[model samples]
Target chain A: MSQVIVVTSGKGGVGKTTTTANLGVGLSKLGKKVVLIDTDIGLRNLDVVLGLENRIVYDLVDVVTGVCTPKQAAIKDKRFDGLFLIPAAQTKDKDSVTIEQMQDLCEKLKEDYDFIIIDCPAGIEQGFKNAIAGADKALIVTTPEVSAVRDADRIIGLLEANEIEEHYLIINRIRPDMVRRGDMMNVDDIIDILNIDLIGIVPDDQDIIISTNKGEPAVVNPKSLAGQGYRNITERLNGNNVPLMDLEGNTFLGKLKKLFTKKQ
Target chain B: MLDLSRIFGRKNNSKDAAKDRLKLVLVHDRANVSPEFLQKIKDEIMQVLAKYMDVSDGGLDINLTTATGEDGKSRVPAITANIPIKSIKQK
Candidate 1:
């Protein structure tokens, strides 16, 4: 089934873009045809994160404005045979594209791809409405910080209000060490407050900076903890009951515990 | 070894504190209630209570919080007000 998923967080700089890039690439790596849409508009950066900045000839605006087709704007990622990205325009803002245009774009792309992941812009504005218009599911991303969780709560409410019922939470940048020391919010603590289902728990790893620096996602690196987390998320998204990552020490016992604590 | 947590006023885990604060803030956000609206509600409660009892306004604290349902898994918006009553009139 072709699924349109929107990656969003009400607050900015909370790993929405990173999760979108890594999840899209991870699904492609797993042999699923995937396409990512950078809906951040004027402040677009998904292309740079995917290392396709120098190849964007046409953009989302051009496709929506009839200047070009979705095929022309869709940049084919060389790393994956079935992966593509529709880069957002750097000069035009969010208002340039309406919600109807975005829906039409997703409906058109759904004919060719298995997954269409839309990278939503921060805040609850026109950009957010446009991003969620065509989405069948939503992935709410947040870090362990209070500000991010608060914004995430608001986003959840908005998603419910918008009638997007199939939503899941992705807690990104979770620090197991800080969580163990009682200095950061753990997965249970966050789920208790947000009252949402879990899908992904990405740890804070240095590999993220290294990958972004190289314009590549961390999911390609098997040794990277963040990469493992993203890969697990891809499996879970595919309806597989994979065990969660043992974030404590990444040991054999942690893996055993993960088997018993598999979340839906 | 000496314990400095009590001196620093951290008797509970910081993550617990963070979770508690996050929940409290979300209650306000989810209710879409501002401090000014809360003050208005408090003032109205005081006006109605003044006819029957002497309610201490300075020490009164009114907040928007969550109320769990019978299942305890479901939650809804609830107004929690703690008012210190000084006297009551015979009615």
Candidate 2:
């Protein structure tokens, strides 16, 4: 059965959707049959992020409401063969689909896909509840800001209360320069606060904005630092001990030295 | 002569500033007690303590401290109240 994972954040606009889209593509690139589901409902944007908006005909609501089959709702990405998207309905509210319905849908999807990625909406409301209902694991995305970390902490508390302890942290939009300058929270600061397994750390990159606008995930662009970070996360997900990409130029020389030592 | 201006110079320490802001907000959030509410509580607690013994009226310290778990699973934030007794000096 496919591992159902929910990408969520308690606060809004912390790159949950972006991370979901890119990670879906990243995992698929690793030859894993991946399905990305948008559980946002009414305010769907994961389709736009994945550039599958124009292809979405029958949405998640359609599949849950029995108006359409799950196969009909699933939109295959042309760029990646094994990747698919189940977009959210733009008209229906989050209350239209219950948690049980979401669980049922995910259970059915698991038969075919290797990974089922749910793009959760902001806040701990019905949408959030529905997204995580069938999730075997969860990735909490948050920025380094105090407000974001505080909300993430609250979300972690809620997840633990719900007995969903298989969750990890992905610190997005990290500015290493600011961290070095003592202007922003570093990885250690975030790890100290959240106290979760660090799955990924994506640096703040203009390439993310550019690729997002162009309907391409940054992970596809090998030169992009954020892309490299997402790729490293994919490797980690596959049980590889891939060292994190050094965006701050801190580990470049060390890595080169290590390569020379291996050659020797 | 001491350089008093140097001693009292403006320091734009953003890290310290951010830490102060976060500490204040976290104390309020973890306790679910606003600064105004805390002021009231502080007064009431001081009054209640004063009934039993003499407390240093305005010198009491009430703050929150956070500690990490051994396995780093979660943070443990606790509220601490320190009230010093005003000793009556022998005349």
DockQ of 2: 0.18
Chain A alone, TM-score per model: 0.94, 0.94
The segments of candidate 2 whose C-alpha lies over 4 angstroms from its true place after superposition are A250-264, B1-13, B19-24, B27-44, B54-61, B67-75, B82-91
The stretch of ten residues in a row with the least summed lDDT in candidate 2 chain A is A255-264
Error of 1 at A165 (Å): 0.4
Clashes of 1: 0
- Report the lDDT of model 1 for residue A245: 79
* DockQ for all candidate structures vs. native: 0.41, 0.18
The sequence of per-residue lDDT tens digits that candidate 1 reaches over residues A1-264 is: 899999999999999999999999999988999999999999999999999999999999999999998988899999887999999999998899999999999999999999999999999999999999999999999999999999999999999998999999999999876775668988988998899999989999999999999998999999999999999999998879898777865655445544555454
Among all candidates shown, the one with the greatest lDDT: 1
Tens digit per residue, CA lDDT, model 1, B47-91: 999999998879898878888978987777898899999999888
Q: Which ten residues in a row have the lowest lDDT in candidate 2 chain B?
A: B1-10
CA lDDT scores, all candidates in order: 0.90, 0.84
